[model samples]
Target: MSRAAIVVAAVACAACSGRMPVLDPGGPQAARIATYWWIVFWLSALILAAVVAFLLHTLAHRRVAAAPASLVEDTRVERRLALGVAAAVGLTALTLVVLLVTSVATGRALRSFGGTDPLTLEVTGYQWWWDVEYWDPVPSQRVRTANEIHIPVGRPVLVKTRSLDVIHSFWVPGLHGKKDNIPGHGSSLVLQADRAGTFIGRCAEFCGVQHAHMQLLVIADQPEVFDAWLQAQRRSAVVPTDAFARHGFDLFMTGPCALCHTVLGTPAGGRRGPDLTHLASRRTLAAGTLPNTVGHLAGWIIDPQAQKPGAQMPGNAFGADDLSALLAFLGGLS
Candidate 1:
């Protein structure tokens, strides 16, 4: 094939490849945006077909090529062209107005709240980690815990988003797109999942060196399962009679860890990192990027910067037993 032909073939192949196309609209807002694109695509295709057919007809029937200058412009033809342009402009404006109105309506539906019946979650973003806090507003009931957020499949979840140091985004691909977590100001995102499964989420904005490693999960489950999970999370951190776990707890509280992290039901009052109140219950550590296991947790505890560059956590210079105790104490948080 000629170079031009090869270039055309490449362009066609690129157009046909849907590898990164936004095939699925997970949320209502995304669905609306996808629908708008679909309408525009088909309409453009129809216009192109009409224009091509008209050009072919004109070329086939032309008597003398390049001799139409003597025909002169017709006033009626000019008037019809002006009317067509005006109609096109008016229709475009009307379409834009309709789209704006519908977008606002869909947004309102997504953000609608029940009268004090919805589950409220506090989602705080660190440099590259996600700090999840489930708020149980009821006085007597304890809220269950997990790193990733979980909600009932059919009910709307109200999430209040915040940031500690830099901006991060909360995005659950199969549920909702994202909302920015800006420091000093709170933003709210209302979303729901229509099905029950684990959906992958990621930090949509870059914050630091580990920004690419920061990811999260959204678990949509039946209400009963969510309730049980919550109960497990709210249980107090394990007060281990085992020497290793007890030593780890001591190392955690007395070492530099206490100055930067928080563990509920204990005196570690730090607020710089994620709350370790229920760390073991979380499926993934390091902001949902690493699996929660003894080895990974040990690595994180010993030298966090090696795993997560630019992390605010410093490496602990403790011995193996002390590290084991810390890992044991953390592992029992679930």
Candidate 2:
């Protein structure tokens, strides 16, 4: 292909890959940050233009020979230069004050949690995945889900953050700014989506080898839809009625998988891994490393390390029949 054709192809591929969340503001906090970004961008651009203009003017009016020493040290010229320097300094200070005030105001707005009883969520960052817990006054209303967060649109949601292991930053760029999840320290941020959409989130801090793949999805839905999803997530795993699924469930409960994963409403109550109560409902597995399809599920079950190098999950060797049955049981989790 020609060079132009290759360039076009590259641009087309980038367009198809979706937008970076920081450039796409889906909420008030992100919009506020974007405003600050634009202010800085325009100010920088203006400074660059002024410097370029002065350089070009100097070049165009080049002196053929050196000026006289008396003219160089002229009192009027020295006074004008001093005034120019002072004016520049004053303008620069004024500009900085404006930026500081704007930044402080925006920060205050982002931290403000004034709303009709915001939904509370505790997000604990792990080695390479997020453990999310929805908080509620009623014990039964609380739900635990991993790598995905569902929230109602147009409502404030306060997310309390912590790190189970090393420091990790919780950042959903389309919704809010990055907040560090420090061990032994509690930090919180408020998020509110103005519209319904699926926004991508990721670990902003580098924690380990699989840090690049540490991702999450924020699904903003209508109140009713969010409530339905919450209710489904709070429920326990469904019991399989079919022979293949039943056999698979028995195997899962008895096998090594039960030691790490939890299936609510069952005897398998392991806490080391992500909750599998509604595993099928999630869009991705292994912290967004792979799509949550039957084929991917089978592959992940057989050899997790091959997919995620530093993943905590070890490979499990299962026969074809058992793998098929296990896939059947897991696929019905939703």
Candidate 3:
């Protein structure tokens, strides 16, 4: 379709979802799965049609009930019917075996993308958030972020996942299948994106009251773009410029926020919450539940429990001046 046509269609459906992830594949794994689904769907449809036609033919051609069973029975016809039934059963079993083998092969292929330079990341599932840690050979170069992941297109990624509390599945249907993060046991998945775009991921398993709000974004970018992003994320946060921001930083370091959150280059090194070093760069707050705007950020920090009933973050009773300063500091993080 032409770009204009596509744009028109998008505008027409602006109120609806933009894409169906299962059908709109951005990776080889998702493409293969969608192919498998269509194959089975069409084959089953054909089989149902065939069965219905046969039943209709049988019903249309009726036999009179004038003779006894022994008198009217034909040995050749009975043998043929038996043979047809046996053949149908054998064919059904064979089809099932083929499908099973194909599915297994596809699964194995999806998991076999390991390479020498594969990007390795650790994703930990919280009650209503995802903590993502990008691993590097140099410990100092490692990065810890939340809810957003950026990867290079066409490069393999090794994602190790674990849950802090309960089972939560990590899935971006447009890129790959679901991988469960068990509470006691860890799991890993190999995934790659063939296209450069953003995909949404959600916790497939229910963990708590905020399960539905638990979401993440996977952004696939060009290699150069990804490298640039990595370099930016690796650096420490910039120093606050204005007085309000500077004062807010001091308040954060002295208050309870310092114990549960970390801001690189500063003394606030708490690991219990998401890193706030480059918090302003992110597009969403509370695991994609709220837009990353000054207003939404203020609401989230002032009363997290009011927005998310089971949120782990407690409401901070900051005075009007303190709140303004804090918001200024956070907003200037980018």
Question: Which candidate leads in TM-score?
Answer: 2
Write down the worst ten-residue block by lDDT for model 2.
11-20
Q: Kindly give the number of clashing pairs for every candidate.
A: 3, 0, 0
lDDT (10s digit) by residue, model 1, range 267-324: 8878777777787777887876568998998888888888877877788888877777
lDDT string, candidate 3, 35-106, tens digits: 888778877898899899989998999888775657777889899999999999997998798789878878
What lDDT, from 0 to 1, does candidate 1 have?
A: 0.73
lDDT by residue (tens digit), candidate 2, 136-230: 88887788989999999999999999998999999998998899999999999999999999998888898988887788899999999998898
Model 1: residues with Cα > 4 Å off, grouped in runs: 1-72, 75-91, 94-98, 113-116, 138-147
TM-score of each: 0.77, 0.92, 0.89
Question: How big is the positional error of residue 109 in model 3, measured in Å on the Cα after superposition?
Answer: 1.3
- Evaluated against the true structure, the overall lDDT of model 2 is 0.89
Q: Output the lDDT of residue 276, model 1.
A: 78
| lDDT of all predictions | 0.73, 0.89, 0.87
As for lDDT, the candidate ahead, 2 or 3, is 2
TM-score of 2: 0.92
Note each model's CA RMSD in angstroms. Answer: 6.5, 4.1, 6.8
